[model samples]
Target: MTVRFELYSTWGCHLCEQAEQMLQQAGLSGQYQVLDIVDHAHLFEQYRVLIPVLACRHTKATLGWPFDQAQLTAWLQLQLQED
Candidate 1:
């Protein structure tokens, strides 16, 4: 099965948009899901400062903000190679 990666984000967040665009430009569209925190008060509250966070759905491994292409790719590769 393909691993599903998720990005925690919100509206009016420039960084969130940047992250989304980075993912897309990195050719990650349709491979991962983006969850807008604005619609979920609880999640938004928990991850407001940590917007643009990435998470592995199955393992729940979270990667906080300020990640780059290499970091994102390496993280996903590590997860995918795990048994």
Candidate 2:
């Protein structure tokens, strides 16, 4: 099964950059899209502290920030299995 991870991010977020690097190191960056929520006020406000959130494309299951390789892998696997 293919998993598409979407990360919500914005400019000036060092943590978001770090998360991107982590995903790349884990070889998962190519499978995801990093969306900048700065232009979307509601999204920006809602996700300011929640930047770097990961979400499944098909099911929309959300995983918040401060995640690592294992958590991301587990979340992706769970989402795929649910589908």
Runs of candidate 1 with Cα error greater than 4 angstroms are: 1-3
The collision pairs in model 1 are: none
Error of 1 at 56 (Å): 0.9
The sequence of per-residue lDDT tens digits that candidate 2 reaches over residues 1-83 is 24487788998889889888877876775788888998779878888888888777888889888888888777878987986
Tens digits of lDDT, candidate 1, 36-76: 98888987888988888988777778888898878877887
Using alpha carbons, what is the TM-score of model 2? 0.79
Off by over 4 Å in 2: 1-3
What lDDT score belongs to each candidate, Candidate 1 first? 0.79, 0.80
Query: Which 10 residues in a row give candidate 2 its minimum summed lDDT?
Result: 1-10
**Best prediction by lDDT:** 2
